[model samples]
Target chain A: MDFNFTPEEEAFRDEVRAFLDENLPENGTRDMEAVAEFQRRIREKRWVGFSWPKEIGGGGGSIMEQVILKEEMARRKAPALGACFMGLAWVAPALIEYGTEEQKQRFIPDILDGKYQWCTGYSEPGSGSDLASLQCRAVREGDEYIVNGQKIWTSIAMWSKWMILLVRTQTDVEAKHDGISCLLVEMESPGLTVRPIKNMAGGDMFAEVFFDDVRVPVENRLGEENQGWKVTVSALAHERSSISEVYGLTRSLERIKVLAKSCHRNGRPASEDPGFRSRFARADARIEAMRLNGMRFLTKQLRGEPLGSETSINKLHRAQLEIELGELALEIEGGLGVLVQGDSAVPDDGLWQRHALSWPEVVIGGGTPNIQKNIIAERVLGLPKD
Target chain B: MNFGFTEEQELLRAEVRKFLDQNCPLEEVRKLCETPEGFSRSLWERMAELGWVGLTISEEGGGVGLGWVDLVVVLEEVGRSLFPSPLLSTVLAAKAVDLNGTEAQKSRWLPGLADGSRIGAVAITGDEGRLDAAGIALEGRPDGDDFTLDGEKLLVMDAQNADILVVAFRTGSGEEDLSLAVVERSAKGLNIEPHRTMDLTRRMGRLHFDGVRVSADALLGSAGSAWAAIEHLQDCAAAAVCAEMVGAAEGALKLTTDFANQRVQFGQLIGRFQGVKHPLAEMFIDIESFKSLCYYAAWLLDECSPEAPLAVSRAKAYASESFARIGVDSVQLHGAVGYTWEYDIQLYLKRAKWARPAFGDAEHHYQRVAKLRGF
Candidate 1:
């Protein structure tokens, strides 16, 4: 029935918050210096892979503690760890669960100590939400697998040193989910190219990665042949439950609250209006709900209940909530909400309006709302497939 | 920081859901929709008997001391059945009183509310404004031992069945000079006029107090401070309403998915087509998102966070918009059959339309959110 942190958890939160206060770079920009400093902090404090097992050079904390850290970091309005989320949350977990001993030894410590950055090469132009339909080809060549394909919206590819890629290894298999296999590919290998994509958020966060006969050691294969779908699914499950969306929503709520108080309506403070009061109540409620939902999901994971299709529910809700919150900020700002970043007339921060504009990426990226719904129907409700 | 329910709460939810499934089925909703009063008094009493009505009341007040999350679970089931009762009004009124009322007032009103003997309704709106207690023009002049009340309250839900009406009034000339008073329906010079609304599943009325006399003790809480109490009650109620909307949205989504799987079009079940499936998928997503927001809002209320007002607004606004959109899409996916009154889709649509506008519409809440966030 309680929602407050225990004294120990609270103390841990304080400690983390204090550390962030001292170590977080003062530069507000998400520039290379900020990224480098963030990586350095991870290396200095070993906070990058808090969820990884102790054998992998991590603190081996509880999942709740990981969630707590994420929430606390977000509450302080700190930037992401910038240590390759794909490597830590996705690839590393998959490796722990299914990788060979050698693969784990080679990859885990490198990722944990921030020596390597990883990008996920799951989606292509033809296969986005329908990831099982990937057309990427990887064929065995002696002791190596020659990889050839293009991955769209591959985040941090330009910054990453390695990639956990899914490719079609056996073309004539019975089912799409069965024929694919996962491989670890070196980003600096010959014939590899990375072209950065400018996102609406005004960041070059994603890239189009091309692998033209890039030679990866066969020992880099993540699991058995024709089992890439399972690995991919497991990785996605980790991503969904990681409470990353909670961080984003928390930051958005804080930004919105500041906007509401400082914004004026007719001669009085906008916060004084009954309408404004009501809306403030709602935004706060949704963020709290998202936080609680994350906790519930974690509880379920701890209890060994199948995570199931409910993660889709969390992703879907968070995307729409973020959009609505962004849109609400714009509405409150009136014309200012729609102001571009460079517009001089805007006050406080032009980023609120920018946030409003960039809100749709959440809904469109990851798994689209439509795709998440199908997952809920087919997997959660067990509705008959047509 | 636990968000998952304890086994006891889960058991309670299961029990309530089972009871609603058996007794307050959709057929009962259909029958009640056609009846004069949208809700059944006998059923209300039965709920009171089962201690459902008193679930949120403190143990000191002759009731269970469950928190907001527990109430949300019960409300969700009530919503799933579309059960017509003053459950929402009674619970909200009880909450308002609990939060602000004097010991005497609590002792006088809570037992009846807990046991369903004295139904209550809140009158915070007039014809033009929506739940703005400040806009009330109701005047109350002090007499020897009582006050003479004069004003009208519009769109009071379930006022016909309520024995006591908690009316908001302006005691001073200032916009914030508002007060709440408990006026009995049987009082002289009082008028109750029931009106038909968009959703027939809930009842609404206008209450006119023309020189109605009430004792000084009739005030629910401190005169001007009633606004804060009312706002708190409204936020809590909004959370419950959003939870209900989430329930209805979920039901509508399931119904549409079932229809899409079974109904044939173009020599195939419509579910196979992206046109039909995509929208249904989107609706499912919207419903899930609404669920998370709704649940979080409820949890926030239980935690009593200072940020609760903002969260409640977001939850209601999102749920209202999502539920209305999902209701329309569900009907559209069902084709001609969904258009008919007998098809049950309209029932959900009507409920959503009613619930969405009850406390505040989506746009209204969004604007409020804008102001809170410094838009």
Candidate 2:
């Protein structure tokens, strides 16, 4: 029943808070430049992979400690380190779980040092949410495989140096889950091209990656051929676990509080209005609830309990709360909440307005709320599928 | 750092649930609602006999000296049964008297309250039933060996059955010049008007203290600093109410899922349809989210953190809105049968409707939270 941190954990949190206070930048800039600086600083401090094993050049912390670090960093409003993708979340875990000794030795240090960034190349144009139906082709020739296909929403493909990709190795298997293979494709390989896609957020955070007869050695394959479904599932599980829309919403709440205090409404502060106060309170409650849900998940992870379908529960709640917060921010600002980031005379960094405008992408990214609902129904509730 | 309940607490929860299932089922609640008292004295005695009445009170005063977590466990069970008793009022009164009352006051009242020989209710709301203590218009003046009380208190729960009434009055004109006085329910010029409420499971009454005379020793705490005690009482009550909402929400979700599995439509169980299935899933998610906050608030209360007030308000406001919505949606998903008086869905819905606006509506608590967060 205790929620307070132990004295030791509290001391550790204080240390981490102090470190973030001393290191994190405080100036405002465009997200791109901020992300670039964030990445560079992360590399300089060698703090890129907090959850990876020490043998892989990480901090060798437990999952709870990692959660604490994330919570503390977020509480301080520190920018996220750029390139938080397969390199840190997926490849690192997969390597620890299934990588050959040589593969771990080759990739772990480079990843931890930020020398190699990675993107997932799992979904093709036809795949989308029906991920097992991917049409990418790969054929074995001698000791190499030739890959040809296109991956949509290959996040940060232009910035990544490697990709953990899923491609079809066989087509006649009875089960669609089989007949797939996973490979680590080097970005420097010939016949590979990346083109950035402009998202609704007005950022080139995602790209389309095309592979045209690119050659990858047999040694580059992870796990086994026809086992790519399992690998992809593992990768997606990592992505879902890393989902902290709640953390982002917490930041939004803080920003909205500041906006309400400083922004004017009818010759008084916006916070003076009962309507704005009510909305702010609702947002605050949602944030607190989301934080506690995260703590429950973290506690379960620490106890080594199987998370399984409960991740869907977290995803659904977080996404809904985030959208609600966005809507509330707009309500708090009235017309000003709709102002764009670059709009002159806009207040409080326009973070809430930007969030309100860009929230649909969050709902669409990772997985849609409808899809999460289906997951909860089928997996968590054990209901019959449609 | 541990979030899981202790083995003892889990066992306590199981025992409480079992006791409530056997002693305070929905039929009993309906019967009590039909009665003029609006509560079951036998059930209250049984609960007290089981030592559930004085959970959070000090051991020297005949309580187990447990914390907020224990009270929440009991409250959740009470909510599951929609139990009609004086548990909420008595617990809150015990807390206020323990925290702020003088030794003489505690010695005079705690034993009787703990042993079920006496019942207590807090009267802090004014004529409009506003939550703000400053809104109270009750006036008290010291007259020799006694204080003359004259004001009307609205929406006092279980007042007809209470032996002691903790009345909040303005000793001076300022907002902070409020005081809590313990007045005997049989005091001269004390008038009680029983009223029917939307949720008949809990009793409500309006009390008018017309020049009621109380001894000088009846003042529970300092004359002008009862605001702190009243605030603490509000936080405790809010936390308990949130816990109750969590229980009701969980029950509604479970009942809806069971109905979804059993009820057939279009040649199959309607649970297979996305429309019904999605909302049910969302309700389950919302219930779980509410549980997290409720538990965190309970834990914060046990820790006695300065953040408890804000956390409790947040939990109460969120649970109030979420549970009410879920209750209504549960009935909608259950089809026409859910709306019938015989069906259990209405029971839950009624409890949720009453609970939402009891301590403070979602909007009221939300405003409290905004103030706490410096908005």
| Candidate 1 chain B, run of 10 with poorest lDDT | B125-134
Interface RMSD of each: 4.3, 1.5
lDDT of each: 0.76, 0.79
For residues A1-386, could you state the per-residue lDDT of candidate 2 as single tens digits? 65677787788788778777666676455666655766676655555676555556666655656666777766666766435556766777787777889999998777665665798897778888788888889999999999988999888889888899999999998988889998999888999999999977778888998889999999999888888777644432222244245666767677778777777679888889898898888877876776677777766666666676776777666677667877766676776776777888666667766676676666777788888898888777766687
Instruction: Put down candidate 1 lDDT per residue, A338-373, tens digits, no spaces.
Output: 567677878555876667667666788778877776
Over B24-104, each residue of candidate 2 has an lDDT whose tens digit, in order, gives: 777877887888778878878888888889888887778888988888888887887788888888887777788887888
Model 1 has an lDDT value of: 0.76
lDDT of 1 at B333: 84
Residue B291 CA displacement from its true place in model 2, Å: 2.7
Give the C-alpha miss distance for residue B344 in model 2, angstroms: 0.2
Name the candidate that leads on DockQ: 2
Listed per model in order, the count of residue pairs whose N, CA or C atoms clash below 3 Å is 31, 0
